[model samples]
Target: MATVADGHHPFAFTFGILGNLVSTMVYLAPVPTFYRIYRKKSTEGFHSVPYLVAMFSSMLWLYYATLKKNAMLLITINSFGSFAEMIYIVIFVVYAPKDARKLTVKLFGIMNVGLFTSIIVVSHFLVSRAYRVPVLGWINVAISTSVFAAPLSIVAQVIRTRSVEFMPFRLSFFLTLSAVMWFAYGLFLKDICVAIPNVLGFVLGLLQMLLYAMYRNRKQVIIEDHEKKLPAATPDHVKNLVIIATLAASEVHPVEAQPNNRNDDGDVNNNAAITEANEHEQTDDHRHVENASVEIQPNETPSAV
Candidate 1:
């Protein structure tokens, strides 16, 4: 917990504080996502890789700060990050599906508990004190850079779905800003290890923002093959129910729909269709059961009295 004097390293101190504030937001950005997971009592398909890797990155930086002199700022922020990320990972494990929860726990043990302890033991005993800083610095750089990998899943989702709903623009912007602040702090402190990985961070953040811009307004299409599996007593009802069944199943096969005519009428119609589809999907389970009931309803036939 050593610190530099007030006059010395003023720029580093100021930017370090800024970096801490920005990085704190970055760490907390996932809170709402996890909160939803908690409320729903399920992790859905959301991956735990990001939070786990983030905690490991924080641990590496915290360890490096301890070895390097006058790095109290690094120590303070990374400590919080480590705590926050661990809480997130734990929450995820608690709420995730049984198979997913087991996998996450296994990964956490292998990386955070096993690998981290191994690194500390080897560094303390095998490496000399003078060489420890540089050795750990390189390790920290590698770990820090891997923090960007957390966003890759979002990036992949954006590409696959052709929608930026998973990647918020504000998060990308702040991440870029945080990278700038940290890079400046590192440069002022003359710690290339601290600065270098942030260069990659900044670049990745910009890339995310760019992807957001590119795909933000793209049209999403949901295709459903409504080949009726259930027998309908009424022929007219069956025809009408076919279209509704397709709309209900649209949630499963979403795709990016490119506009063809690019005319006002076409635009209006497309918007209306998209809106109806979204609303239809909001009550998908109910609509599905309703459709099944419609298909199985018995028809009355007039009998001789």
Candidate 2:
């Protein structure tokens, strides 16, 4: 019986270890994306909010782990998480444009510096050490729950655009798997605070995967009826008028003719007048042809014809 109990303990420990391993993998999944940003020298429209929230959650978990006994797993995983998130943020700030960099800085200050400091100060002075772990654990749970909700915007964008280009299936799949592993670990440890948020995370992850599968192959259909509804090309007469105007512009200037003898200037002016008259005649001919083309047939109604 002693041997069996020891065997069960090892199995339970293995489960927790596996869960932590998977969770760490998920947390580091964005590393490649950030690396790309670093190489390209652009954030490429990837928002800093997710990384900021992840860092904030890691900070909270680190505090919770410090307050709790036998929380080596939490400390180890969240420490790595904090490091990874900081690297991501650093790359984002370096590559991001001025406006995005400013926003990211403001978010870091508010969440990491301002809010985290406030939480630590308040929790320390107001709450007793005996109750600190539970209090901070619940706080971590709340933060994780909110982070799980962050994918909703991406989901909505996928549905709205009918494009999964912004929504990465690998991220969704790993996140879902991570949530399941963590939930199992939490359940085995009888930690409701960890288990509960992971349940929400699993559901949201599943929803994102479902959305991706549904829309992945679907093409966006854009009808150009508005463009088609625009008035047809200008009539032939109008085209002839434009052509005549262009020809008139290309003709030698009357001032150029004046530099010649007076007789030559008069002849040139008369020739230009004659050319203008011929252009007007051609325009009238085009107009007549256009009007004749518009004539209604005697035997056919206008719409039917």
Candidate 3:
């Protein structure tokens, strides 16, 4: 459905401008995330799939805009998107850890280079010019829908972890608002392909916001409660034995020491006692009490467990 004739409607132009504004915000929403990656010098768990898919989507839209008339808005915004996503990809490649970098590079080659090139070739050579716009537009619709639904994984994470940290309210709000703006734009332009995906976008965005509300105050308390461990219970018998040992230890008096000597038969002779804290000196106020333990000389023999 080439909308060359109907696309110039005044209402369409107005909504298109609004769509451009909101969509630009949507495109740039990941700026802070990339900034974090840059500062930390690691990608952490953030995947390159979303940005790569987005870049491919924008490239597809750029080609679609080229084929259609009155598509300047598409061209202008997608040009900015293309540049922004490229910068993010470059930053990711630079700071990502070794394994993450390798995976990201592989995905980049496959999605942004190889797959995109194939689409371009097929659109230009195999597909007839008349059907090009429609075919490409549908492809974009599919990709856009996937982009909107990509947060399903995040939603699951939020639910499982009982924390809203995974989903940002500002991004969700912008996504929903952007959906509304673009939906109106496409509605005014009589372009169903543009209008269709935003319906899903708006719905999914609302779902995310509602989830944020439900668990925002909880702050992962539910999961943490389950993860927390209570102190192990002490047996009554163990407690009684500890009490007896402590009393017995507290009542003990100092023992006198005898000087070492060698017997006339040439055997070593010594006197020892089970006594000592870190050192072996007993005074009027001195006390050694560590689980009722006492140091014994090696010749005195070891204690049984």
Which runs in model 3 stand beyond 4 Å of their true positions?
1-7, 229-305
Model 1 clash tally, residue pairs: 0
Best-to-worst ranking by lDDT: 1, 3, 2
Error of 1 at 57 (Å): 0.6
Q: Could you tell me which 10 consecutive residues in candidate 1 have the lowest summed lDDT?
A: 245-254
Name the TM-score of candidate 2. 0.67
What TM-score would you give candidate 3 relative to the actual structure? 0.70
Model 1, 44-89: lDDT tens per residue? 6566766777788889889988888878889999999999989988
lDDT over C-alpha atoms for residue 276 of model 1: 94
Candidate 2 structure quality by residue, lDDT tens digits, 76-164: 78888898889888988988999989999999999999999999998999999888778888888887887777666666656665666
lDDT of each: 0.74, 0.70, 0.70
Candidate 3 residue 216 Cα shift, in angstroms, is: 1.1
Mind giving the per-residue lDDT tens digits that candidate 3 earns over 169-285? 877888789889878878877778889999998898899899989989887575345334212223433334222222211011111222223343334222233334323555423
Q: Can you give the lDDT of residue 81 in candidate 3?
A: 82
Candidate 3 at 239: error in angstroms? 43
